[model samples]
Each structure stands twice: as structure tokens, then as C-alpha cells.
Target: MNPLLTASGLHVTFPGRRGGPSARAVDGVHLDIGAGEIVALVGESGCGKTTLARALLGLVRPTSGSVGFAGAPLSYASRDLKTYRRRVQLVLQDPSGSLNPRHTVYDAVAEGLRIHRYAGDERAAVAAALSRAGLRPPERFFLRYPHELSGGQRQRVVIAGALVLEPELLVADEPVASLDASVRGEILALLLRLRDELGLAALIVTHDLGLAWNIADRVAVMYLGRIVETGTVEEVLSAPRHPYTRALLSVLPESGAEPVVLAGEPPDPSRIPAGCRFHARCQVLASGEADRAGVSSACRTRDLPLLDGHGRAAACHVHGTP
Candidate 1:
């Protein structure tokens, strides 16, 4: 199947303060989202998942590499970029912050339509989007403001805003990170329904592995600025091969394995260490498992190759297999 969106050898860099070295926020990431598919990009706070999402959406032009849509490389020209943004809408992390307090619920959801200069029945479009987002009898909430709604309702408004655009792909960054557990499930299920009903594909950026298990068809594990492992949800999460992935899962309540708390320095994009960016905090290397696998030296000295478009792959010397 052809991918609806693709990022190839993607890199995003931010200049450091006071003429310091540059920070590589996204380093050589290759990802794809098939039509109507859901892929989760999972990592810790500063591992560049958010930056990757922004780049994919054309909000931040990549420092290097390319983003493709529907088999063609993306063009950054103003008109072209606007069209891309319309086709690929973003659902941000914080609904409270994303919505304008001054705007009524109807205005909030209709904002996209107005911006895009929709010539169709604007009120009907807004009502349909709100209803699809589970805001039943949407007309009742039309005049309400963001502060008047619950956390979940605010999030629904945000989703409705994106849905109003009738986008083919939704790049949602931590869509449920701010909501309560019960509300989180509702949002995830809503996304699934949107996919089944509207044939929308999504690239959801989040730190929660459990969310990936519940919502994604495929999961990509990121560390520092790179995606170190990726595969089907069942393949990667069920039998994780990368130490970083294993460590993440170990911290979960249901994971019976001993906690694999990462030690040493947290990831720094400015000075990503030589060799495996994750080697310094990898429990597998610390446990002599890499040595037993006869790849300890390689793990500390050489960067693992970029993951291939294979069934399942890990970017670790000891676990570099598909």
C-alpha cells in the first residue's frame, strides 16, 4: 500500500545559544503512515518526537532530508505548504492552551473552515464535525466557551476543529496526555472511529507505551533524536528487542520484569555522544549482555545502521535484526 505520508532521512536542528554547537532535534528519522493507518511515535520528553511531528506537518522545515506525501516529495512553497497543512491537520498536546478562551465552541470548531475559505454550508460542517467528535446535539454547545467545558470536552473541541478540515491525516501530539484515564480512552476510541468512518490516517506522538498498545497499528521507539526500534504493535511491544524499549516497558505496572531505570546523563541533542546514542544508558550493555553477544565494543564505538523497511527492526548493535 502507498503511504499517505513519509519522512525520509529527516533531520531538524536548532541553533544553540551563544554560538554553541547545534542541537539535532530530529536525526535521520524514516517513518511512514499508510492510508487509514495509525502509527505512534513514543519516547521520553526530549527525545525529539514532538519535533519530528512538527516537521512532518510542515510547521518546521527539516534541516535535512525530505517529507513525502502520496509518493511525491513535499514542497515548502507558501501555497503548497498551506495545502499540505489543510490535508494534514495537527491536534496539539494541550487542549486548554490550543483553544482560544475568547472563542465560543462553535467559533473554535469553525475556525479551520473559515481559514480555509470553505464555500460549503459552514454551520452544517461545524455541526457535523462536533457530532462526529461525540459532542451530541452540537448546537447546544455552539455558544459555549472553552472554560465552560470539561477537560475531555475541550479536547473534543480541538479534535472537532481538526475534523472540520476533513483532513486525510491527523498528526496528534500527546492527544490524551492531559486528560484523565477514563477520558483518555474515549479520545482514543474516537480516533479509531474517525479512522474507520473518515478513512483518516494518524501519526500520534506520545510518551505512553500503553497508549500505543491501545491505539497504534505500529509503534516506533525513539531515543535521543533517533527511532531505535519499530514494528507492528504486537511484534515490538510483545517481544521488544532494543534495551531502550525493554527499559521503557519494564517501568510499566504490568511488566513483571525488574525495573530498568536508566542512569547517567539524560539525552542531549546538542552533544549526542558518539556511537550508539543510547549505549550510555542501555541496561543490556550494563548487564554484560552486549558483551555476551560479542557486540559490546561495537555498541560503544559504532552507530547502528538505520532501520530498514522490514517487518521488525532495532537500531542496536547487539539487537540489529529484523
Candidate 2:
């Protein structure tokens, strides 16, 4: 199936401060989201998951590389950009911040239609969007203000705003990070429902591996601005191949394996390590096992490709080999 959104060799860099080196927030990421699919981009905070999501949404232009939507490369020219924006919506991490405090639920949901110059019945569109987002008897919430609703309801409003535009893809950055733990599952289930019922594809940026396990069809593990491993959720989560991926999974409460506590913080993106970016913190490189000499050398000096020639892919020299 053709991807609803595609990003290839996407790189985004920010200029340095005080003549220091530039920060490469996103580095050579290749990603795709098929129609009706939910792909989780998981990693530690500051690993560029949000930056990559912004690039995909065209909120930030890439320093290099291309992003294609529905087979056509994204065009930043004004008219094209406006059209693209309508089809690809963003749900930010904080609904409290994303929604206007002064705008009532009706106004918040209706704003997109007004901006897009939607010709349909504006009231009907807003009501339907709220309904789709799980705010049933949508009228009950129409006059409510952001502060008037609970955190979960506010998030549903944000989602409703996105749905109001009838977007084909949603780039949600930490959709549940700010909500109570009790409310997180409800929001996740709502997203899954939207996909199953409306065929909306989503790229969810989150650090929670457990969330990925719960809802993602595929999981892309990001480290230091690159995807180190990507595969079916079962394949990647059940049997992760990348050292970084394994380390992440090891900490999961249900893994029943001792947590593989990594050493050292992720290096500054401006001074990303050569070869394998994770080599500095890789357990295998420090183990000094006699049989792992070749793998260690490669991990320290050679940049391994993300693809491992199997259904699952990992950017590790030792991955998939005996």
C-alpha cells in the first residue's frame, strides 16, 4: 500500500548559539505511514521524535531531504502549503496550551472550518467532529470553555479540532503525556477508534514504550536523531534487535528481565559520535567478550545501515547475525 505520508533522508538543523556548532535535531530519518495505520515513534526525550514529526507536518522545513504525501512531494509554496495543512493535522502534547482558553468548545472546533473557508454547515461539522472525538451529545460540550472541561475532555476537544478539518493524517506529539494516568488509556483508545472507524493514519511521538506496545502497528525506535530500529510492534517489542531497543525494553515492568541501565547521557547532537551514534553507551561495545571483537570494532567505527535484510531492521553491526 502506498504511504499516506513519507519522509526520506529528512534532516533538520538549528544554527549554533554564540558561534558554537549547529544542532542536528533530526538526522537522515526515513519514515512512512500507511493509510489507516498507527506508527509510534518512541525514544527518550530530546531524541528528535518531535522534531521529525514537525518536519513531516511541514511546520518546520527540513534542512535537506524530502517529504512526500500521497505520492507527491510536499510543496511549501503558499497555496500548496495551505492545502497540505488541511489534510495533515497536528495534535500537540498539551491540550491546555493548544486550545484557546477564551474560545468555547464550539468556537475552538469551528475555527478550522472558518480558516479553511469550509462551505458545509459549520454547526454540523463541529458537532460531528466532537462526536467522532468521543464527546457524545456534542452539544453538551459546545458552550464549555477549556478551563470548564476536565483534562481528558480538553484533549478530546483538541482532537475534535483536528477532526473538524477532516484530515487524512495526524501527527500527535505526546498526546497523553500531560493527562492523568487514568485518562491516558481513554485517549489512546480514542485514537485507535478514529483509525479503525475513520481510516485516519497517525504518527504518534512519544517516549513511552508501553504506549507503543499498547496501540502501535509498528514501532520506530529513535536515538540521537535517527531511527535505530523499526518493525512490526510484535517483532520489535517482543524481540528487539538493536542494543538501544533492547535496553529500552528491558526497563519495561512486564519484560521480567533485569533493566539494562545505559551509561552516560546522549551526546550533544552537535557533536554526535562517529560510526554508531549509540556506541558510546552501548553495552556490547564495553562487554569485551572475546567472540564479539568484530562487532565491537564495527560498532565503534562503521556506521551500520538501518535495514538488516529481514522483516525487522536495526542499525547495529551485530544485529541478525550469529
Q: 75, model 1: CA deviation in Å?
A: 1.0
Candidate 2 residues 241-267, lDDT tens each? 888898999998999978999998999
How many collisions between residues are there in candidate 2?
0
Name the TM-score of candidate 2: 0.96
Best by lDDT: 1
Every model's TM-score: 0.98, 0.96
Query: What tens-digit string does per-residue lDDT give for candidate 1 at 135-235?
Result: 99999999999999999999999999999989999999999999999899999999999999999999999998989999999999988888999999999
Q: Candidate 1 regions off by >4 Å? A: none
Best by TM-score: 1
